[model samples]
Target: MVIRDFDEFCRDITDIYESTLPNGEGQVASYIPQLARVNPDQFAVSLCTVDGQRLSLGDSKVDFSVQSTCKPINYSLALQLHGEHIVHRHVGREPSGRGFNELTLNHDGRPHNPMINAGAIMCCSLLKREGEVNVADRFDLVMDTWRRLGGGTRVKFNNSVYLSERTTADRNFALGYFMREKQAFPTSTDLLETLEFYFQCCSIEVHAEQMAAVAATLANGGICPISGERVFETKTVQHCLSLMYSCGMYDYSGEFAFTIGLPAKSGVAGALMIVVPNVMGICTWSPRLDKLGNSVRGIEFCRRLVATFNFHYDTL
Candidate 1:
């Protein structure tokens, strides 16, 4: 088994989950009204090892919007559809060192990386409607990918959250226009279609239980642990995880890399997906967010997790 003494490991995880419950700092993300109204006190942690061991605590089964946590999956799909060379042509692989939604591009006139809004929007544009008839077909392809990543678990769409995101998407719209102005997007890219697709991707909903399976797929080198199916090429996962490590935490990327030493992505909806390559995948969800837009209880849970286990990349 990937985690020896699985029963003992689960007990340790339970202890960490209980210890993180009293944290009441931070606020729910209010920019999106639907997200703002979520129960901020709710917290959950779920994990799945590469060998298929599983554990969940608190509100692990409760659904929440995926939000920015969708970036790595979308980027992976784009890489699988088009090779790295083609994908990187429009999006760089370096950290942006700015806000996740900053109106900036690299010196080469590309979005810094696929983890940020600009780069994620660029990735949405690359998922061409080839072979797919309409925008819904394209989104169906994305949903299919998410299902594969989640070990064939049912993934749901949140039309309300999608509408909320679309309604409050002025910044993303601005990003699309700015990229078009810079000639960054592919020729004939439908700016409106791309932005709506981005919002739709963000609004997909899943509970921590499902997201842990998704993370485990990445941890197991793009193979779903439960289904034992290869969902992505190994090289695609390597590239995606590398960027998630360096750029996934918004402005806190550097600090998170330095301290946690694990590849993780945090969404404003208070979802944190973490991968311990060749070992396990973890997902923590709590709607109370820090100023940096990370989940307060989720961050605490991760801190405790690493301190208890030698999961840190730098750990000898």
Candidate 2:
């Protein structure tokens, strides 16, 4: 099953995608009104090799909210801006056994890691903590980074998703205030602004191919293969990959690490972004989700992908 060339790789991807299409085993996320309305049958699979070879299958051009897939990028940005030591001071690099929106923290008064809601909120607060940049400027920075990560493609914010998230973000707000009570946030950090920015990031929209490019950027050690531009420090990507590997797929992180063996992040929007470091990036979208809030087709695809290719880090 070695994919010796781009054509073979593309063929295999399409084959795998088609084979997995009939399982239709999960439900669309109904908590968010916008997400709940998406077609549950819509699916896409995209891959971008380290050398910039790209392939897509199914509804690859359809756009959807990035959801929690934005966590790793936002975490990387905060680490790049403030360094690991300072960032770790606010969020621990550990997995939360609970769900993504749990109002919990580690013993040290920090969110377990940047992949969960609490940690992500802390990461958002840390983004412009120096107060040198306004919230608008900070958001622009995030969007600019996302665009470059997507290989210079345009990625937009879905206002409907943003509004939906804002309306149903009671848990996130509770997490924020909980962290604030624990003094996990920075001294000058504004809770409301940080939470708003976090929701905005989660609302960013991109197709499967674009998200694959973003994952490929991280796979390429923060250098975009297509653009030949450095998007983040190598150390930043390293830190993010580490956290994503350990905590990215909500509470299913441990099992995914054992089976898929890749650094990846999953969003409630049924998006999965995987990084096969030094090899390629893979993105899969299916609006239907398993009970654990992961894309059912996406999880199956990763299993099939590693079984078909030498993608598992251990195998490589």
Candidate 3:
């Protein structure tokens, strides 16, 4: 059963956020014309425990595109479909030791890991359905996962954002072709269409409330608290979290793991999700990002969480 302490936890988080949500900060991601238009000052945070407790603050009802934060879910699905050996054939486990959008891969032509731009694209191909692997079907599964995770009855595409991704996706297009040349993505799928689907996956919208639940699934060892279902294998969650621990925050992974001390993921769309092992999931969303494209306020809140709670999965 959901406990009362979690409600107290929420109140503490809300109070902390209200006092310090970054009055002065950096800019939001504007590369994708649509995201550039979002209100930069908007911020939110949410938390959930394995026992089904929940807490939310600051624009809790607002939905935001998940962006690269979508990598872990799709990566888990890819691991389920293709298995580890085959999936590793296309992507590497080592952190790229470079920026996420470096437009390059490891010497072996594999994406350094499955969390960056190069690797996430590889996962999109890896997780695509067998017969046609179209966006509609792939997106339906993402929606299913969201419904199961978020407890929301409905989820839909942000068409304007999706189109903006398509229009400004030249860099990703180039990455796709480079991978294809390396035999990394040796398929007949059109690069634009595949990238379109990738963009749509990033565009899949959810509020901090649902994101807290999604993180709770990971914290609960893959069990959906609200849905009473298992969306991934236990081993898969471990692998996904391990990868997140090592590389999920894009360029900020090491610092994030050190400061926040949680297995976490961040979106260029200014969303953050952190998993606290058997305890709970914490999520923060704010459009303003530091140079690394991680949410500015999101990082500060996590810093406070780690410091105040003495939380750290590694320490556990």
Candidate 4:
């Protein structure tokens, strides 16, 4: 077993979860109406080991939009569809020190990385780019990929969130138009379709239990631990996790990588996915968000997790 004392580990995690409950700091994200309406106090932590052992606590079954957390998944799909050389040609692999929604590109004219809105929009254009598939078919393909990543768990689409995102997507629209103006997208790309696809990807809904399985797939080198399915190539996950470590937490990416020493991605919906490569994958959800948009309780759980266990990369 990857975790020697599984029972004891569960107890420790439970303690951390309980201790984080009293933290009333941070506000729930209000940019999207649907996100703003979610119960801010809802919190959950779920973990799955590479060997498939699982545990969930608090509001484990409650569904929440994946939001920006979908960036890493879509980025992995783009890498699998197109090799690193081609994918990096459109999106750089360095962290953008600006906000996640910043309107900026690298010196090479590509978005800094696929973990930000601009880069994620670029990735959306890459998926199903052959023009053979329609928008619905393309989104269906992404949903299928998400299900495989989560060990065949059901992945739902929240049309309300999707509509809300699209309704309030002036910034994303600006990014799309800016990329188009800069010729950053591939030839014959449909700008509106690409932006809508990006919104749909962000609107994917899964509870912490399912998200833990998704993280575990990445931790197990792109193989879904529960269903034993290969969802992505090992190399694809390697590149994806590298960028996640350096660019996933918006402007706080550097601090997170320095302190946590783990590959993690946080979404405005208060979803945080952490992968302990070759060991386990964890998902923490709490709608209360810090200024950087990370889940407040989720961050606390991670700090307590690494402090209690030798999971940090440096600990090796």
Candidate 5:
């Protein structure tokens, strides 16, 4: 909790994140009008060590949509419920090596991995059980995870954002139907209900501290360091973080894996979270996106943080 190097790293990251913005470049995901109004200049960074030290930088308190990063958390929940062997039958563990919108699945239409849209839909479908009361109950379970992870305060529903995603969600809808076609989805699954839940989950806004805590839970083998509570099963967490390591970044997963050497995930809402086992967990937010649709400043902050802090786990 008291690592001197981490204390200094926080200072540096805070300085960088506080000083940058979207500038005149980078396009927002405006097909959803709710996303269009995000202050392009907003940015934040939050970090926590495995021992529970907290270092907050920039607008780490500012709320932002959870976006695709929700996939792995929900994936963890799915694994906890269904077990690894059953879940693997429906979703592949490999990275898709393309943008998130690409609807094609594996040769068998099994989702390429849980980190992508297709895989996320599949994960959502897997959440639907025969005895489940309704979609809200499932969402409540996810919210319970958020609460235990210290992100409860940051959870806010931007109705407009949800609606906007629904408006432009034809690609996502197509993915669900295509999965259904290939037997990737259950015969009794309700496509629209699943899609709505997925979109709403993506719209849940969380601050960086909550993100850091979530990452720390993964770092600590599924236990929240701050809350001292177990959220998901240990094996399920391992599976989730492993996928984040391989496919968290849509098309840029390869480059990020090669360069960062930390298991991380990014959201279209400009939130990027990284987890280093027993070392630290970090989250960065900058609304300006790079060509890969990742946060430009967020990635820049992580790159600099990794470079300055000696987090190249694989090289060493």
Candidate 6:
């Protein structure tokens, strides 16, 4: 089961992708009307090695909303700019043990971690927001980061998805206001602008291969393999990946860690970005989701991936 070379790795991944094609056992996310419309049968798997070698199969070039998978990247940016100490003051590193969007906070009034809705919102507030840095500037910075993380590929925002999420995000509003009431955000935080920024990050779109590049960057110690650009600092990537390992899969994080044993982040848009440490980064997309909001086929691919190769951190 060892992947000695690129061809073998491609062959094995193709086999696994095909094997899960017929087993569409979950539903596309319906709460977000835009996501519910994605073709449930569309599936893709893409991988990028530390050396920048790449492979993709089935709809890998098709674009989908990056969704919550952007959390780790956003968190990384926060840590890079604010440092771990300042960032952790607003958001803890522990798992919430509840739904990703559940209105909850730790005993210290901080959001549990940056992977969930509350924490991500807090991370959004931590981003530089002041005079001369308008919403457009904020958008450019985040999208630019996503582009570099995607190995210089263009990553777009789905306006339809953003509008839909913004319109229907009462839960997010509640979470934001709750944290604001608890005085969790910075003194000058603008709640509306922060939530808008958060929605924009969640709505950024990337193809499967593009997301694999982002994951590969993390796996390669924050260096984008395709471009050889240092996108994030080593410690920043470490902190983001650690939280992703513990809390990135919503309520399913614990089980996913136990079984797949990789640092990963999942999006409701049916995407999973997985980091294999010094080995590679993998991305899988299938619109069918389990109750906990993870892509079912994406999880299956991770399980098979670890089984076929020594990709799991614990195993290594």
**Can you give the TM-score per candidate against the true fold?**
0.98, 0.98, 0.94, 0.99, 0.94, 0.97
Clash pairs (backbone) in predicted model 4: none
| lDDT by residue (tens digit), candidate 5, 257-288 | 88987788999988888888767778887777
Over all chains combined, what TM-score does candidate 5 have?
Answer: 0.94
Worst 10 residues of 5 by lDDT: 16-25
lDDT of 2 by residue, 1-316 (tens): 1236778777888889988999889899998789889999999999887788888888999999999999999999999889999999999998989888887889998999999999999999988857575889999999999999999999999998899899999999999988999999989888898899999999999999999999999999999988989999998999899999999999899999999899999999899999999988889999899999999999999999999988888888
Q: Model 3 over residues 1-316: C-alpha lDDT tens digits?
A: 5445656766777778986685559898989777888888898888888887777888877888888888999888889888888889889998777888888889898899989988988888876656765577777887887777665446666888888888888788889989988888746656666677798888888888888899999888888777768877898889999999999887888888777778899998889988988888878889998998888888888887777776776666
Each candidate's number of clashing pairs is 0, 0, 0, 0, 0, 0
Candidate 4 is scored at a TM of: 0.99
RMSD of 3: 1.8
- What clash pairs does model 3 have? none
Tens-digit lDDT track for model 6 on 1-316?
A: 1235778668888888888888879999998778888889999999888888889899999999998998998899888878989988999999899899998899998899999999999999988844445778777889999999988878888999999999999999999999999999988888999999999999999999999999999998999989999999998988888999999899999999998899999999999999998888899999999988899999888888888877777778
Which clashing pairs does model 5 show?
Answer: none
C-alpha lDDT of all candidate models, in order: 0.92, 0.91, 0.83, 0.92, 0.80, 0.90
Off by over 4 Å in 4: none
Error of 4 at 238 (Å): 0.4
Clashing pairs in 2: none
Q: Candidate 4 residues 47-126, lDDT tens each? A: 99999999999999999999999999999999888889988889998888999998888887789999999999999999
Which model is ahead, 2 or 5, in terms of TM-score?
Answer: 2
The residue-by-residue lDDT of candidate 1 on 219-244, one tens digit each, is 99999999999999999999999999
Q: Rank by TM-score, highest first.
A: 4, 1, 2, 6, 3, 5
